[model samples]
Target chain A: MLSIKNLHASVEGKEILKGINLEIKAGEVHAIMGPNGSGKSTLSQVLAGNDAFEVTSGSVTMNGENLLEKETEERARDGVFLAFQYPVEIPGVSNLQFMRTSVNAMRHHRGESEMNAAEFMKLAREVSKQVDLDPAFLKRGVNEGFSGGEKKRNEIMQALMLQPKLAILDETDSGLDIDALKVVSDGVNALRAEDRAILMVTHYQRLLDHIVPDFVHVLADGKIVKSGGRELALELEDRGYAWLGIKDDETAANSAN
Target chain B: MTTANKEVNELIKREYEHGFVTDIEVDTFEPGLSEDVITRLSEIKKEPQFMLEWRLKAYRRWLEMEEPDWAHLGYDRIDYNSVSYYSAPKRKEDMPQSLDEVDPELLKTYEKLGIPLHEHAKLAGVAVDAVFDSVSVATTFKEPLAKAGVIFCSISEAVRDYPELVQKYLGTVVPHTDNFFAGLNAAVFSDGTFVYVPKGVRCPMELSTYFRINAANTGQFERTLIIADEGSYVSYLEGCTAPMRDENQLHAAVVELVALDNAEIKYSTVQNWYPGDENGKGGIYNFVTKRAACIGKNSKVSWTQVETGSAITWKYPSCILRGEGSVGEFYSVALTHNHQQADTGTKMIHLGKNTTSTIISKGISAGKSSNVYRGLVKFGPRAEGARNFTECDSLLIGDQCGAHTFPYIESLNKSAIVEHEATTSKVSDEQMFLCRQRGIDMERAVSMIVNGFCKDVFKELPMEFAVEAGKLLEVSLEGSVG
Candidate 1:
């Protein structure tokens, strides 16, 4: 469902993602684990079409369409969703209104009529139950004054509502408590299907314990140095990333090779 | 990315949409400022002798007054001799009693302004009085408003029919010599809307005035007066858009509002005068004075504005809380882009005990534009236990633009409490990224954030005006976000 070849990206002229090559098929879940500044967040931002980062080399495609050429909204409409690490606080726009607008924009892009207010409210109510988010929260400004756990749940609720083909969870478990993590993982697990893919980016293997990955790739500096099964995350958790003995430059060179 | 670039490219080629002058015939007065022009304007309106003398007095006062240079705006000197003081659409000898009898071309002009004379066909329940150049083109929903004992008509007609009312409240809030523009407007003002809500009656519809300037080399000096009697309530809206002209056109307007015992008045404005081109060569010098007075116990008055146009705009819509327990509020969102300059805010005065006032102002500046917020809150000696709260925030889209806030608070009553807060920040790249990562594009994201920032003020606007104000912000910031 997704492919990245030699993806080299940078922000403000500083290289972040160097030669990241990865592929994920439908129904597959992948976990990319790395230390801080290992280009994990950069990878998610680049995939979501953030303009601040310049893709110096390579390409990304989703379902055989050129994702790099699309605007951020177009990319989302094409079924790519990114759960941001820190959700934005839009002070006066209610969560329901934001969700409705996003859904309508995506639906419009997909050549579908917009959902009316009644239909949208019905859908929102049903999804709110599944995500265990308070229905009252939908009427509040998007993430304004919301606690850390509420924001995470709201992000998951948005992903569940959109039902994207590919979901990128960028450290969705960072600030969540144990119960919040369980609920978020449960929401993600419910959406797993034969035609959808999930990419979980995390620092600790604890989140992987809830939403198990089919494959795990270790990213160092800006390049992926190791690819293995779920056991790879457990191995890295037991032993630090130094177990690889390969420096970041070596990994870049190796990826180039 | 492509959408942002497209908007930027569009801004690069932005042209004034309503810059053409229709070839309609007009009865025009000679250019230049003099007692003769004032006398001619008053006589043309067939005003009472007292009004004529009043205009002559204001004209003499304006002659002695110098144009205000204190506002944080820069503009070339206005050539008073090059502007026609009075230019009205040529009306028939008999006034039109119904919309059908109005001139078709005049109706077309109002239609182009989105203010058709059919109330049922209009959106958002806006009963409009369309003023083209200097004369009222059509007034809608007159029958329904008349049934409610609400008198809405052209100021010229009101002076003839309801002379007592007009004489009682004409300059009650903002006097003729309040400012240079107010004095000028009082001197040669041609025509504007007059609204009176009778005692104990709540106006059933939103009263709006759509002012358009289509005559060449003509200055539009419109004077508006709205009075809500005891136990009455009313909401009034004013919107202005001028056809583009290469030479700067002067528009000096004065608006006065009065709220009596237990009355509430809400006034909103969405000013979209023709902003100059990127080089800032020519546009409207919109100098306006708007003020409301709370004259009786427990009276309330609120002013809300969404200003997005004009090359140089200088206005301060203020409130005088004279009654005990009266309240005054001002909410403003002023945006300037592409060489526009606006110096606007409000003034609140507390005279009686336990009066309160609140002011919230948000300024957005982009593309070398300058926006300033200057406000004053004053408490008199008898204003015991009076309170005031003010918050002013500015968002700069680019480094080239500027935003400033100047607030003055004075209290002579020892028991009064006043607090003010202000902040200045740019639409940081990080905020944009947060929105983009959620699949929102840059321009929409910027607009969303900006709307959120000004939501407080937007909510204070009438429903229709709120929607128009939102769209205006989008259009004003078309190429602003990078």
Candidate 2:
């Protein structure tokens, strides 16, 4: 359902994603693991249509529609979701308000009537429970003064509420405690379905234990250098990236190039 | 470069919707101001002898006073001599005794401005005094208001009928010699609304007045007076719009409100005068003076204004808390875009013991516009244990715009407590991108954020007016993305 061909991306005159190719089918979950500066976050941003990353060469398509041609919001309307590693704080804009606007925008794009206030409130409450967030927090400014763990859970809640076709979780487990990690993973596991796909990008192998992936690819520099099964994450965790012939950031970035 | 951004660009190019000139013959004075002109205006209104004397005295003071330049504004020098002092629709030999006989064209102009004269639309039940150009055309819901012992009519009519009320409170709150614009307004003020709620009475409904400027080269000087007697309460609303023109039209208005013993008055205004073109060609110079006096113990007065238009605006709605335990509050949201400039705030004077005041101001500047918040709070010697809290926030949408704040506080009582807080913020790219990525478009995102920024002030507005204010801000900030 998703395809990326020779995705070469750059930012501010520096190439980040160099000659990367990947294809994922429906009902599949893929994990891309790498050390620092392995272009893991760059891959997620380029897929989500961050304009700062210039896609010099290659194309991305979702269900035969060129995802690269759509604007960021249009991409979102087309069912692409990105869980930011650092959630933005929009003071004065309540989280509930933002969620309602987003939900209505998607509904409009799908030729559906707006969700009524009561119906929206019900859906919001149900989603908040799934992420273990108190509904009262929804009335506060979006992520304003939120804890590190709460921000990650809020991002997951947004993904769950939108119910996108392809979800990209970028460093969702970085700043989470053990309890928050379990709660967030449970929400993600609940969202897994036959017609949806999940792309998990992480540096540590810890998250793979919670939401196991069908495919694991090791990204070095800007290319996917290794593709394997769940066992690959366990092996990397035991021996580290050096065991896979990957040195520290200095050598890994050059050798992969 | 998204569809939302493109739509915002188109909205920015939209022409002024309320700029159409009404086709009606008018009785307009020649372009100039003199003692003779003031005398003629008083005679046309058929004012009492004292009214004429007041106008003449104000005109003399105006001549001696130079235009003040203390405000944070920049514009071409106003050619006062080139502006017509009065322009009113020529009344028929027999004026309309009811709404039906009113000129259809004049009624249509009000209709086009989303104001209904039939009294059955959404704004029904609220008494409205429609002032066109320099004279009031019609007053609606007068009978209902009158049956409730409420005196609601045009200032001219009030002078003719309830002379005592008008004479007692005309310039009491904002005296004729208050400032440059106030003096000019007092000198040649043509027409406005007069509202009086009798003692021990709460007004049955909201009282509103709509001011429209259609005549070219004419200056609109309106005088609005409202009096809430002892133990009474009233909410008064004022709104204005002007037709588009190539030359800046002058709108100098004075509003005075009085709240007697244990009385409460709430005054709200939504001012949307023309803000000229994108490059700032022609608009309205809106210099208005509004003041309320708490004259009796425990009397309360609040001023709420949403200012979103005008090429240059200089206004300060103030309250004088003279009575013991009286309360004063000011809530404002001022937005300036596309070369528009606004310098507006409030003044609160605590002259009695235990008096309190609160101020919340929100200023949004977009495009190349400039917005400033200038406020003052004073505590007199007898204002023992008085308190004041002031909060001001400024939001900038683009790099070319500017925001400034000037707050002055003076306290003579050692027991008085005053607090002030101010903040400045920009619409960052991260916030914009986050909203866009969530499927909400940029234009909606900008407006939503701005509305959130102004939520405090908007809540103070009446329901209908709050909705209108939200829409006005959205239109004003279109294409202001940086």
Candidate 3:
């Protein structure tokens, strides 16, 4: 239920995503793998309505609604979720307060009454257990002084709490330990269902082994160069991006013209 | 602009909520200052001979005192001669003997500000001395307080009824020569609350005073004195508000407290005067002096204030720890927005052995306002084994606002220990983006964050007042986020 056509984006007057096209129907999981400078994170941020990235020429639609025209918060209420690679720390706002406010916002948009504190607390405890986080973290400031692995798991916990229709996981496994990776993957696996789509952006194939994807695409110089089935990931894992005839960083990216 | 910023911009434009004027006839003196004016004021109140003599003496001292300008403030020179000294509601009879006798319009004015003066209301149980303009029209829970051996009434009444107590303690802590503002307040002060807790008695209920300035071109000078006799304990609260006007009105108030042997006193204030318009056209210039003296051994005193308004504020509530093993504490939360400027803090003077003090100050500045924290902690040679701890934190919201800290510390005894810490922070854009991404409204996010920053100070306020203080900060911060 998501479509991106010839999406071109830039930051600070320098182009990043150039004429990339992708479409995914419901109940499908798509993984886009690329090198360090292939604009993998930039693509996710642009879709999340980050104003820093200038969407020069393209169109994005979620269920036929113009996604680019909506503000960041409106997109969030419209079931769009982005798991940040580096979670921001709000030193004084408790994690429980932050999550409850977000969940209530989504429920309000769906014409449902806000949940009371007691009811919200029960749901939050269950989600925290699923992500292997201690209940005590709820009382602490949001992501304040959290370990790298805990922050990644907190992002997964938030995603599970929001239950978005279009979940964009941007390098969720970058900083997780092996055990935390297992817990986070289980949470993501539980999110799969009918009428929902998932997009995973990553640089490693290790995450692919946990929650296998239906489709894999190789992104290089802001363009999806190759598309294949699940086995393509294992092939690319054996031979690096150079074997795919794509330079990682020093390519200048002039080919976008 | 993004939708989050756009929504906040609208809220930032909200006008001050308590800006309406009360329509009533008033007896106002012409705008000027002289010995004749002070004499007329004392005569109108029909004070005792000693009281009139005291006012004349203070007026002479005020004349000799050049208006002090050493504060960290920038403002036009105040024309003292151009300000009317006395303005009170026109009354043809004696003071109101009961709620039924008070003018309905005056009661309505208090009602519009969410302060119910009727005895049946729950708030009336707190014993409020409602000071309007330059005179006190009503005081609550007088009989119950009197039964408890607590003398609670207006200062004017105290001078006439409890002359011995008034003569014993008035001006003893902060004398007429204390400072410029205190000198002015002592000379031409109109009316304020006077509270006395008898020996070995705890006040039956919290005492509060609400000061309202409704007349135009009149400066409000309030003088308050609270005495806790030996082995007594009491808590007093003061709140002030004024109507919106284009001419800069002046508010000069002096508050003094005295604690006897083993006695304790707690004072709290929430000052929300008009802070002028966005371009700084008109508001109140609040210059107040408040102090307490712990003269008896083991006495304690604490000051808590939440100041959120005023075009320009200059106040420093202080404590003199003269009793052995006495304790002093100060907690403050000052927020300034629009064109407001505030320079407020506290002072702790240790003169006896084993005296201790603690200070926690939080200043929040938004829009084009400026907030400053100026504090002093001094230990004399007799203060052996004394200690003091201080913490100051500032949070800046917009790019144009400013925050400053000036802490003066002095110690004569080698055994004295002083610890001070200061920090400055901002509401970063990334933090805003994070909250906005969660679909929380802009106003809610800012208020929540600011409330968290001020949680430490709000807890020190009384139970009901803590809630009001939080809401006041939210209202004050409105339209400050653009």
Candidate 4:
């Protein structure tokens, strides 16, 4: 469903993603684990068309369509969803309103009719229940004064609403607790569809223990140094980057020893 | 990103939609201001002699008064002599006796302004009094209004037919000697709406006035007086959509509202005057004074205004809570794009025991515009247990614009409590990215954020006007996204 060839991206003229390549077909889930500054988040941002990172020498395609040529919103409408590491706070804009507008925009792009407020509300309420988010929070400002777990659930709620073809989760599990992790995992497992793909970028195997990936790729220094199945995550958690000849902190290696 | 910002800014430079001149012959006073000019204007309207004397008194007082320079505004001193004080669409006979007798051209102009005068068909529950350059053309549903013991007519008609009521209420809230703009408006004011709801009577329909300044080189000085008697209720709307083109920039107007015992008055204004060209060459200078007096115990008055146009706007819609346990509320959303400057807020004066007031103001500045909120909350010596709550928020769209807040609080009563909260925020790029990434366009995203910022004030507007205000904000925010 998604393809990246020699993805070289940078921020502020500093190279972040250096000549990286990845491919995932429909109904597949891929996990990219990396140390700090290893371009895990940058990959998600660049694929979602965030302009802050310039794609200097890369070509990305979604369903055989050139994705790099589209704007951020256009890419979103084309079914590329990026769950931001830190979801932004838009004060005064109700979550329901923001979601409704997004849903309508995507529906319009797909040549489908726009859903009325009542119909959309019904769907949103059901989805919020699935995510364990209070329906009352839907009426509040988008991520305004929301707790870390609530913001994560809100981003997951949006992913569920959009039903994107390729969902990119950028450290969505960073601030979630055990209970929140379970709820978030349940929501993601529900999105395991026959025609959709998931790319979760995380720093630990804790998230993989719930929503286990079909394939795991350890990204070090912007390139995939190792690729394997779900057990690769456990190995990384056990041995850390030092086992792969990459130096991070001594804590993970010392603990492994 | 640069290209996107360019497109956004281009949309922000939207042409003034109602800048086309209405081609109609008008009976106009030569460009000047004097006692002779006031007399001639009064005589033209067939005003009572006492009314003329009142205007003369105001004129003399205006001569002694120097224009106040305290407001945070920048504009060249107005050339009063260069502006024609009066310009009415010429009629072959006396002012139209009914809607049928009104000129078709004038009606067309009002229709273009979205206030149909030929019939009360479009606006089913709202009765509108359409005011052209310097006089009222037609007031719809006058008979129905009169049936309810509610007198809704042009101020000129009220002066002639209901002189006692007009004499009693005019300038009672905002006295002619109150300030520089009020004095000038009292002396040279040509025409405005007048409402008098009798005791125990609730106005049947929404009363409204649409003020349009069509003629070139003529200043539209409007005087509006509303009096709600004991146990009465009324909601009045003014200045819908665009105020059309005004070659003559000065628009000094006064509006006074009075609510008696147990009476309630709600006033809403959607002011879309011309803000001039992109270069800020020619636009209307809107200097208006609007105040309401809660004169009797338990009276309530609320002012909700959405001001989006004007080159330089100096307005302060205030309330004097003189009645015991009286209440006053003000909700305003003032947006200035391009070179527009608006320094508008409200004054809440607590004089009665247990009186309370709430003020919420939202200011949005874009394209190098300057928007300021200057509000005053005062409590008198006898105002025991009186309280005031105020919130002023400013949103800047682009880097070029600016927003400011000037809040003054004075309390003589030790028992009084006043709370003030102010915030200054920008239409940040992160906010924009969040919205755009959700598949909304730039315009829709900007408007959404801005509308959320102004949700508090917009809720106070009438239902239909609330919708219009949202669209107006969307249209006004073009090019501010950068």
Tell me the whole-model lDDT of each prediction, alpha carbons only.
0.86, 0.90, 0.89, 0.89
Per-residue lDDT tens digits for candidate 3, residues A1-257, read 89999999998889999888999888999999998888899999888877768899999999999999987778888888888888888766789988998899889989999999999999999999999999999999889999998998898899899888888899998877889899999999998988789899988888999989999999998999998879988887776677799775522342231
Best by TM-score: 4
Q: Model 4: which docking level applies? A: medium
Which candidate number maximizes DockQ?
A: 4
Model 2: share of real contacts kept: 0.59
Model 4 stretches with alpha carbons more than 4 Å out: A250-257, B1-11, B120-122, B240-248
- DockQ for all models: 0.40, 0.52, 0.47, 0.63
- Model 3 chain B lowest lDDT segment of ten: B2-11
The residue-by-residue lDDT of candidate 1 on A51-72, one tens digit each, is 7789999999998998999877
- Name model 2 segments beyond 4 Å from true: A245-257, B1-11, B93-95, B119-122
Model 1: iRMSD?
3.8
In model 4, what is the error at residue B36, expressed in angstroms? Answer: 0.9
Worst 10 residues of 4 chain A by lDDT: A248-257
Give TM-scores for every candidate, taking all chains together and pairing residue i with residue i: 0.94, 0.95, 0.94, 0.96
Candidate 1 clashing pairs?
B19-B244
Interface RMSD of each: 3.8, 3.1, 2.6, 2.0
Residue B386 displacement (Å), model 4: 0.7
Give the Å shift of residue B313 in candidate 3.
1.4
